[model samples]
Target: MQNLQEGERALTAAVAAAGRTRLWSHPELGLHAFVDAAGSVRLGTSDRNWAALVPLVEATATGHGRLWSGERFVETAIGDRLAYRGHETVEDGGRERTTIRLADSVTGLAADVVLETCRGAGFLRARVRLVNEGGTPLRLESVTTLTLGGIAGADDGLGGLTLHWADNDWLAECRWRRTAFRDQVVPLSRSVHGHEGRGCFERCSQGSWSTGRHLPMGALTDRDGRAWLWQIESSAGWRFETGEREGAAYVALFGPDDAHHQWHQTLAPGEEFHTVPAALVRTEAGGLDAAFGELTDYRRDIRREHPDHRTLPVIYNDYMNTLMGDPTTRKLLPLIEAAGAAGAEVFVIDAGWYDDDAQGWWDAVGAWEPARGRFPGGIQEVLDAIRGHGMTPGLWLEPEVVGVRSPLARTLPPEAFFRRGGIRVTEHGRHHLDLRHPAARAHLDSVVDRLAGEWGVGYLKLDYNINIGPGTENGPESPGSGLLGHHRAHLDWMASVLDRHPGLVLENCGSGGLRMDYAQLTVAQLQSTSDQQDLLRYPPIAAAAATAVTPEQAAVWAYPQPGHTLDEIAFTLAGALLGRVHLSGFLDRMNDDQFALVRSALRLYKDIRPEIAGARPFWPLGLPGWDDAWIAQGLRGRHSTFVTVWRRGPADGTSCELTLPHLRGARLQPSVLHPTASDSTAEWDATEAKLTVFLPRPDTAVLLRLR
Candidate 1:
């Protein structure tokens, strides 16, 4: 390894001799990278403070080098021996992409590290492309999409850093945990040991549910309020780790690997593979909220353009706490009428619309046709009724699985389904489809075309319920690599569907938020946040959903029952006002007053949705806790700021104050924007930049506008 002075002199000489250097900096993106003559790269926010840095490409392959290799995914001999080839940049619109190329002389392995950023943005998107140039096959164990180091301050090394990550599961999703960096990665006294630590704090996904265990997002914040927020965009397997390195802190994000997801790849000569994308945002002072806000902007830019994001039509699905998959014509017509009357723009007949057997639809699902026994007059009758009420008709379909007993399971070729050791894979009575196969892709394409094109359905709710363990085995490919291939093929199929029917809307749901990741969100128009039935338990998920998804795409259910009090109805409705409204429950049985309350909330949401499309999210009271008594979330727009505060349990205090540093010392008038007839009151204190909201009763929430 070259010393700092020697590396600088080499860079200067290279630049002066051939107009090339080992240092590359992008002023517009605030990105600084150092690639030594040996092809070793180090990335950070600044250039002057680079020291004892980790390599940009941390990879391990079969018959490769591992210096003190143990559990950590770093310090590989191949990453250190690669020689720098060249780099090029391309500018398109306001975004610029730079590709740094490198290759290993010993193994004939090559890599292209692609980095992209928008002009005037504080974030960077990175991915790697690998090719095998040697005659022999190379089996790769693990590869990093992005690695960033030099995270500590000049005075405080790792003492002032705090680690933040979110825990996700069925119903209980987006529960964040924050701890001191030292707690997870304790001091090892490397000065005396004469070596770096072998362990680090790591989080990874399991099975098919990308977010079943933990969200693919995490952060590190300093005492000075600076933060680095990052997310790995993969619908397959993903892992991220942060630990103390050379007295500082470093984070490495990856997509599937042998140790984590049973994923590996054997590349033949001239074959190439591209890893999933990952992003990182650096905020100098505003902490997590500011970093998330920047990430939100980046998400909006990466998504496929669709009108559904801007319109944000209120969708009423008869599934959660309502029809519960038994959607008959007798049960759906009334609800469709009530939903349309309550201001729903789209009505979805969820789940059991296809069951004809008395046994159940769970294990007999593949055929998406309407059931004659349930619909009697045919499912078209219910869809017609929805359209008559001026709403877009939709149907729920899980296209990735076929019930083990379904006729298609036997008819389709065995290769169309996921298989290992010449046996088909089954999970929860359903067989997973391998979309990479032509027959599987053809079957789904036919189903979607029949519903969205022939039937004139304007929306389709795509749900994935089962976790099919690791993945299918395709010859020499590992299960993890097969899973990655299937996921990418699924994404391509969805994009093709949209290309055929440009006006249609697709809702991404994985037994409600389990498959929540940007790789799916970028293609789908909406994401179901959760399937929690209790209204009190949903505020935390709703408040913190924007950390993983954009505001317009995060769909929250608002199911107000006929038996609830007026306040209870308001509570549920207000939670969905900031996000895409997923209305359910027995609206047909609600009294005139209850129906009017639902209508009024939807009307208010419609009026404010335009601002929401462009607003940046903020946590006035910080990110919400699972059991917090008082939860607050705000969206800062160009013209005004909107805040939603929820108070739960037996409140000891009737009011709580939310600090808004941006509005401090500015003249403002704040007012409650929802439940015009409620006891909720809000007062703005311009002097302190705080909004004190009073909801006299428990389990109540209010949305306030400060301008």
Candidate 2:
């Protein structure tokens, strides 16, 4: 083994800056972080080291960032005010780890900054742990997981840096945009005072929908072409911001704060609380793509080892198209038989099975037991039918909420549900469960165990549709704090369940991508990207999903219905080609021609699905627009590259050209992988490094595999 020099790599720390600070080096990516004697953190890339000391700390307050802190400020980890306590370095499985402890000089509060760098992953994982060192309890507002100071440096200013973030909505997720700091320029003259950031760039996700409004992730590219990508891997409420302080640039991220979700906690003496982990990747020569690609690798590394990561099975759910929540034993038998014949490995029976009331099933949920009135013979018959077709049986469950009119809603104690001002919080005909309460966890665990243990259930589509705004102010310091506790409890419960039932598959669906965060992605088998019935609007969402999620775990709906031409059917199926193939619609009603096209797409998906696990995403037309006439997305694997193009609306001609940057000079054979209702053509322009596709009309798509 070779002994590397101090402060060269592997998160080695050493004295620097005339003994004023300690420098920690990230070897694989060549990024350096400095902790001053005052415990202020700073960052510098290999391309450019800093000349002025930058303060690496951010908190929810009125003085920093653009967002308001809800008129409450608990100043703890906010600037150079914290004192450097001590640190420890350890090694595990050839990976180096460092945990640096910092404390508030005025108060009996302290925090630990955890840093981990692997051998060759070219990324670092950072998280913070808050501790109360006082004899009395201490109140806490919010703290950042990781803060990078000197993003652009004091002398140079933020003019050289570009800020990048993604806007994620329900149906249209992972829409990324880049902006230069100079564009939103807020000039601060050094002649008057020191550098102070103005007009800070800020973003946040409210409520339980972690990705509802915007992704808790962003990136900064410096003038020297070096880029840094940072993501807060939390499923609950989170926020991140970029701002200029003096001539330097700073970035701060936190899980939850009082301003957004009314969250604050009083830490008891000797108690500790840890925030969610954040990932940062620095690229030496490449820009955003290079940094983002490294982030993709980091995302894969954080995911738990599971069978879904390997098998990449095709799933069939009878919710969007076929059943539409009117499930019966009679109706499910044929769909089950047909889906199995179509080669779907998992068969999920969607909602409407738990209803016995004549009104509807929406308000009669929470009692997960199947309604004998609807099934006539027993729900077991349908389960057996699914198994008889050689497919795994799955069920849809909304375990976190109790319908307003449900019997359990009236029976369970009010403490089990989220409450504000001594009353239970209700939204959209439902009451949100506070998983921190023992009763709530017990009820949910009972429901899950009954379904999985007794009924032979293998897969679960966990769906959350409602959001209790702000948070639950049951008995915590604030509503946001209570919600954060519930969120942590929920994750712990999920980990326990998965540990107990390793083979069980959990599908995450929060009104489709609304609650799609890394915390859920680590536990859930797959995520349903959207429930957009409009196939036309789904292409952009499906195409851009790879920016925030792995294509392998992303499930896009492909519902081929009757009265559809072969081209139209292929278009719908192609929407799900690059991601998970969630086959839908009334397959029992399709003719031989229509059914053949459906099966063909599934077959093609199975062939390319394995590559998706190891593939890297590239968009030729740039991050897709909501109403673009043409869109192209590509996935480049080790051996072959798969590209899908959509000619959605009116176009000038029968052909359009797309550039594949990864295969610019390589000789490749291009083939139209899917035979649609109409004839298609693909021509490779070697000199231009573009592929020209010939299509007959609008509302059509095709998959081209370049080998």
Candidate 3:
């Protein structure tokens, strides 16, 4: 026993002699990580002290990581028991990537934490690779892709930290709300309890709809304006939590977990699993505006290259309040001409284009054939009409599902469809397609080839309307793992389609912003921001769309009816000018003046699109409220900054002030770029960096340009 104690002391001395603690810094991203001899990592921004940081890697396996008394994903035995391996850094195309390796001697679990950062960028992209080096299988319940600690206000402790998250729904997407961190994660006296609290403020995806409940993105800001923003890139399932740890705050981001997502994985010897990618952005000051700006840049850097991101073409879709999924040649010919005249570059024939049956087309929709009765001259005639008006032809398709009554549902193998208990899973009269199967992939490939290749379609709006519950049970894998596999395969299939048809623009729509995550947005060219029909209720969504997606990739609807006043028409049109324009409405029947107003908005958008493609989004009045009387959103570029303000209530004569601190001391000019004849006015105060704008009428909106 004495010899054993002496040997343990000698081993501890050897570890200390070998440098028990090491600090790793990524100056470009302002990230500092400290690793102790026990392989516990604490990550923080350079602005925080190393001593305040907590363990970075948190994991919970079947028989490990139960040391702490909490549902929180920290203090895992595997995390604390790991031994730090050497790290390697590599530079590729001006971006630097560093990999830190760690291994647990007890469980034989090895992890490679990979972080990638671009030069001069203020964000870090992170993912983890977990491998089983033991002779036996290891079951994993949860593992964090990225974890950060040591987050506290410069002056106060956790008292100054404010938590911000967005509540997402079908129509009410990106409804950002903020509260004091202490309000959600109440103080637990560690001095009395002698242990961390057992609860955390967590937001997680319920099922297939990643953003069905809340966005996979959030922020923490201090009173002094410093901000830390994070986003988990997963279309399958995700969870993010922030809680008090060791007198400070820590954030843990996970892809999927057993407790919340029914996702667990058993890794055999020599097997490995990779977590979904996540990103973090830290700003010294400026709060969410600055942090989100850096995140936008990072998003642009990581997404697949496509021309639609740069061109920012105006798209006219025959959905929303216009057609309501019922369309025909008689209804489309005039609209095509009118849309082309309104400067639309793409005209998409939305749902019901393939419905030939008297019954609705919702369930019987796998076959994407144009109805002969609706288009007696063939769908090609309308396609040619769109081309005649100098616009590219597009179509809407829901590729991930097959109608219960469709022939493809019977023809596709059972393995190709989502199955549970040896029976096919059906939802809303549709059977979900498991893209991991070759047959399912081939079917979608043939469909895309037929539309984009044979018919020469330039754009495709891939809509997913049904959430197919947990996932398929084809193999001996958890339902969560199955969902993750399908999500990855779906992304790969989209990328393959783009590789084959590089010019084809694909719009990602999941019942309107339900699947709004970076995993899908990084591949698809555009994301449908929402399907809200009421123009009045759309301002908040439009104002906060940038918080969920990049401005260039976010698609907002601008549906102006002919019965509305000029202000109403301009109000709807202005909401879409900052992002990709999805023009709808009865433009064919509108009076000349109303049509001209839409045309003017489109023309102005065309002029400013070059700057928008390179701009970073900022909210002057902070994130919009669901029922706020006033809302404001801005895009800042190199030479110009544009602001869009909407007044929805409080009658007339109401004005709002927007603070743009970045432009405080500049000699500037402010002009109403759209609806140039409206009664709305904008005045700039360089001394205070505030822009006071007034729209004399309610339900009115205006777009302003500052240079």
Candidate 4:
């Protein structure tokens, strides 16, 4: 034991020395390895590996005799560190001998490794640069591997969780299986599933068979596919899986197979891409959510630095229904008033604010004018009405589209619009504005600036109805014509607009849920789940919202439509409570019963808004194959809790049972707040292993106060 301790000390000293040397001499190079004070060794570097490997391949081609490069060593007080950062000139028989340069603006040296204490979590972040450094186009097929330390004889409890691979259109064509070193390989070909329209692949295995587990991590392409590899592991007590992507380049605290999240990038010759993978390590205490919260908070800080940061939640109202009928400010004012009375934070006037001409929806899109016949006084009247109701006013705009018949169409040249066969084509009722053009960007900036700076609008709902063609006039070119880069540029333009209008809240909508990715979510606070507004549709919508994003980020809208009833409306409103609620129903058309229920729900939501905002929810019932009854609990602090229950269909004359987890050691008292019950309150001890509570029919909710 003494000798082992001495050996560990020596290892730690050596790692520390290596870290110090790398940090000093070549702070920006390949495969840097270092050790922190906690004795965890970290190896990482900026995408330099692609460049480093290029020289080796070239040497092999040139038939160089065992092409070798000298290593440079640096000395520190603890130990010595060695690094190699030069080109290998090689010669292979009958192959062209090539000397590959190790450095280029995009293909060269990048910060590759970080081994340090990040926010109190001992972690190792490995980054590698993937550069197209060779004359012949190259593709990357790499896998990230990690070997567990101090677990040679001990068992790593990866068995408790499951592994899920995110499904993608690209990954669907391939067939694969998960194989264990000592155990049977699990065939997961059909096991892969899709959620919220994205792909999710899953498998479960026990880590007790061996101290190490190898996961299939490389992109299965012979030539043209490249991907950055990410791997994370935590102390066994956590509930989340070891291999999963949660829509971002990270894992979730809930479970591995729960969802797949990743950021994808395609690189062209002489072009490079960069991404950050944040890791959190909990020493047998916190879960993935706790770690994610740290990253979320960091992102929030970055968002706050932007000039336009909206603090209040915004909802979609009125304009979506305009497609069915003429939506005038007078028709929308009452609904806005009711929504305000019902505790709506912001009211957005959706599409149809402008008049369409022969040129299509594009003509009126960039022009921020209300239809003269619909609103003689213009949009300011609607803004005033919303503001009068004590709610922030938001307006929808599709600056990226232009109607050919619009007044600006004659003013702007045809070259400003995206064209097909020399004619501006219409898509989804609008013509795409060439956002890739500098003049078009300037026009959009001016349009947004006028609304935010001049019109006093506090919020803007930007909509994109169709996908714009990747700015390549020719067919697919190398580096892929900067499709994502142009989209990112458009995003930057929007961010700049927000920077100019600091108070404006931007809600992104791509015909609803199409652009619901991390890039858009990072800039926009809320996203529309779907265009549908029926109350019954809220369950699947809310479930999808829960799966893809946090409840706070979802913007769920509901309207009465044709078949929805008052009771159904209230129950549907209850579903919206699980997320950020948006109202679009005709408030004036509702009877007294509907009004009263809306008032009650609004009061209840306002009462526990903070709890709803901060609490972590557990879906005890709803969707997941359970009946029409649904139960969700929001727990805040240690003693305060809020619970919502909904009984759909006829309720079957039988009460549903609800069991509360994580509520031990407290006295929980639940009460029915709606539908007038004789015995409203029930007291029980929460310390029991499980407590089953009966839920009445037609959707019932109980608030539990712990003392």
Candidate 5:
């Protein structure tokens, strides 16, 4: 079995061999497009397997080339460089030729397989083209699978894992049990559920599932309406049952079936089909959020070079109803000043700054104007105020939407709006902008430029409240084209906006958790977890924390109302230990005791900010369940650590014993600090085994520091 590094090398060699045949030069990252050696056509990288495919060709192929027997074939090569193409061809006499073409756009014909080493956790992409060279339309079925090289086992590093999906449910047919060579299998029962408007159907899980064990990730689907994407991190592992079922056609190593799954399309007389699969390895170095952030940086470096990239953290001021209507500048100015004093790196002035009449701000999204009534001195005054407070100011814009009453609706080109005739007009208080159109890009760019250059806005929160329809609205188009226009437009807009703003922070939001996917994460700096911030909703939030690599980049807001005590609020705030923190409560309304508590917690968070931001997170207390309490901790280096614990409902007599891993063999001192009590500290040696701590109910948390 080849290791990741060795696999990458092998793959690179194969691409080089193929490149010689087509005489094509390889393209650099971000700028290159995969092409076919036979016909010299362009092929795009798969969304899932980008890392694996890009590097191999860049290292081997160079120049231009193409390989396609007809329009219905997949052809990809290293942009203008080496070309590697594989496809099936049918002759007039009912004969078929399935071949892999490798040619250098510079040199010419090479070998078959481009075996490159798989560095870190990456993917291997091979373009499959099916052409009707014999003057007839062809019907074909194909699937691409990678055989991993590693010892199969359960304890070899895989266990306690769960798969995530935007919409779907898991089914357990049997408990996980070890098989041969440390391999394990967990049985999955078939289940049906709706996921974000799509029907999901999972076949029974009948394959071995492991965390970092033999298999890191896997997906399986027939050419039907069922598809799956499964991934598990090395830090968290789970067991499952796997075996042949009585009626199933094939056994999948992982994933449940969902109804909303869509299948790859069929190639007509002049059509083509493309497929891609990607895999990544996880580790105990940090939570998923941190890991993802690192990956994003790596991919960015591989693709394009950004000269002035810097990390910027932000806090929202108007989220707590602090800024509504035409409030006196005197009232709002101080809060912004206070937030800046509290070490808030960026200050955002949310909605209501725009009026429906002037600049048509509220009703007119397309017209970028500040309401004169709301901002008597114009947006420049607000910007100057934020700058004076020693903080960067950010503005929120829902550029994708437009209100019906806005003047732009009547003046703008009719094609700008998305509609389905009278039955479905793109009207929902605001209409979504057609990003695919050139005019839309130009308009958005103008607005973004004004905010960045004119107002000196350092950050932009781009929010979208709608989904795009397929290209079917454009007439009789292919299923792929239906969504392609929107996809292309989104990519183009993101690239353009980021290029224009350079170092500006772009936070993506879709009502909240709806857009928490890799595609969006690639372009935006942060994502909102969900709108539900009630203290009781911490369990699901914590669960989601593991799924995404950077929950710290998630927007988590906390506040204390009249009925809730400061201690209760602190307990709730602890749950945010797994991610970034956003506070929305009215600070001025709090009493001295409550204010003091906030100050104390803020101080502690500030002290351990580095650790909480960079270290691997430990959910000592499992996901928050109703009537259940738990603790979450994160440790950085050897001496710094932060802990957060919460007790929901009435206090129970139950005490939780937490066994700390990665801390054994170290000298440590632990202390408990309550809002009403003084801090108590104790010393212990963790050299021999895991350190155990006991917590009584009503929820209490302790911080551990190494001496």
Candidate 6:
């Protein structure tokens, strides 16, 4: 034991060593790294036999390498070794942003590696830019955003390392699966190469929702308890791969893989191509949750500054149960009144507010205007009504598409919409607008300014409901490149809208979470987790959403219907407790008793909502299974932990236990934050480091705080 402790101390010292270059270390997080003069990177969590390796950040031209024989980062082909050019560092909101420049003289390629961090933060973000400085254009086949070479440097083989991959779908989001990195990705090999060889495990997102097929994030944990999580922030194509080769194992992150993406950009002289930003979190203590907890902090650090994320306002949309996009003045009055009474901060009149009541309103939606019949006294009357209740008025706008039958669809030039082969690309009877074009931007800007600026609306729920496949082929670039370009332009446009309305908040929704990516989340104040109304299935999405986004940005609906019992009402409300509560359903029709339950939950949500801004997410019962009878997701704050547990189905899961060893050694006082029911019981079993709960019936939920 003494010898083992001495070895661990030696590894700690070695991990902290500056080696050939000055090492940058996060003082409190125990993360350390250094880049040598040759552009080789050595980093890790400072645990023995568990270090990250990046011997090369290679890029191969058409004629480079052993002609692309599984070679990473153009290592053996360049005539001259990559040399460190210089470095620049800047600070943003207390975080350090460093740009380290490296160049290969023979290849005439300059790589600017950008990294972000803080003194005590447990995470760092990295990306690379490849610039062509040579006399002619070069066709680059493969370029990796980040190549974490030697991810398992000291180990003979990555036999014990585990990879955690997150998967997402339409209603099902943030599903995480943990498997042996070797067995799942790169199979453990009996046939070894020298003393340090390994196989590869790779996963990637092809287009659009990077988490559509699988999330653009993953984590690897070693036997010694060292864990590192890496996530890609792009909404477009992104990839991450883990492999063993030569004498080491590696994890490489990329924006697009040329093999599948058909992406090969020819960089002209003085031209540059930058990869998407990616972040990595490392921890040697408390396992995966600890690493992710720091990642949560890093996620918060990277988000664009906004007050709404801090406020976590409860939104009441006129969609789900009451109106369903067919809101009239009569329908809006009673629902709006109930919403205010239930403690909603923003009352958004969802879809169909603009269309004539007689016409179908699904597709012809570009020209955003209040219908004469729907709003008899104009939209302002409803706005005044909402203000009278002391709540902000918001409206839903699908700014990206124009209805095919709408006048603007024919009036706007073909160049304004996504085009292919000299024609507008129509999907689901709606034409997607190419925001990159000035005309398209002008149209949407006018709509936003009128609603938010003229009408004094404080919030805009931006919705996009169509998928134009890879993208439009009308522009000079490929469809994928065009899509990415439009994505950046759209984000800029959203920022401009925010600038126009200083107090306005934007909600991002793409057919409910199809575009729920970090790129959109950065600018948009919040994300609609799902449109699923099933109270049972929603718990999983709400529980898992924290993995994909911060709890504050995850707008989960706590819709309680008029027919639901008190137990059923609590079950519905619990899903949104730890997230941004997007209250919905037919509250106007609900009885006073049924409505009181919602108001009780809302009061509790408002009380604890502030702490959620600075909280770190955790799955006390692990990532909630889609069909799990009982599920739990929680947030740990500075002085308290808030947990929401749901018992669903007739599975007789009223009696359940939760293990929260995070407060194991501390003296904690536990109490119900929401539900406030006399029958619901949560008793702390300190000896076992668990909290056991018992409810009399199914479809019931409870919110508990342990401080």
Task: Give candidate 6's whole-model lDDT.
Answer: 0.76
User: On a 0 to 1 TM-score scale, where does candidate 3 land against the true structure?
Assistant: 0.96
TM-score per prediction, in order, is 0.97, 0.92, 0.96, 0.64, 0.64, 0.90
Flag clash pairs in model 1: none
Which regions in candidate 6 have their CA more than 4 angstroms from the true location? 1-52, 65-81, 88-93, 153-157, 186-199, 246-248, 357-359, 650-653
TM-score of 6: 0.90
Instruction: Name the better of 2 and 4 by TM-score.
Output: 2
- Model 6 vs truth, CA RMSD: 5.7
Model 2 is weakest, by summed lDDT over 10 consecutive residues, at 66-75
On residues 1-707, what C-alpha lDDT tens digit does candidate 6 reach at each position? 01111232343344346444434456664555555434444444342433235433656667665323452332335412555555556665666766666677776888877777885677778888889988888777566666554555226457777778877777777778888766764543435532232325667766555556777788888777677788887776677777654335567777764564545667899998887788888787666777778888887877789989888888999898668888888888888899999999899999888988356877777889889988888889999899888789999999988888888998888888887667788888888888889999999999999998889999888887766666666555556666666777888999999888878999998777767677788888898888787878888889888877888999988778998888888888888889898888889999988998899899988888889999999877878778988888889988789888888877665688899887776666678877876488788877678988776677778888998
TM-score attained by model 4:
0.64
Give the Cα lDDT of each candidate: 0.89, 0.77, 0.88, 0.43, 0.42, 0.76
- Global local distance difference test of model 4: 0.43
lDDT of 2 by residue, 125-156 (tens): 88888887868776666677876655662236
Q: lDDT per residue, candidate 3, 1-707, as tens digits?
A: 01111233444454567443434577755677666555566677632454456555678899885677667877788877766665666777677787777788888999988888977789899999999999999999999999888787877589999999999999999999899999999987888988778999999998899999999998999988899899999999899998987678889899999989888999999899999999999888888999989999998989999989999989999999999888899999999999999999999999999999777788898878889989999999999999999999999999999999999998989899988778899999999999999999999999999999999999999999988887778778888999999999999999999999999999999999999999999999899999999999999999999999999999999999999999899999999999999999989899999999999999999999999998999999889999988899999988899999998877545798899999989888789998978877888899999899988888899999999
Runs of candidate 5 with Cα error greater than 4 angstroms are: 1-278, 282-314, 320-331, 357-364, 419-427, 467-472, 478-480, 539-543, 560-564, 591-593, 603-606, 611-614, 621-627, 631-641, 671-707
Q: Which ranges of candidate 3 are over 4 A from the true structure?
A: 1-15, 18-20, 46-52, 651-653
Clashes of each: 0, 7, 1, 31, 107, 8
Model 5 TM: 0.64
**Ranked candidates (TM-score, high to low):** 1, 3, 2, 6, 4, 5
Residue 311 CA displacement from its true place in model 5, Å: 4.4
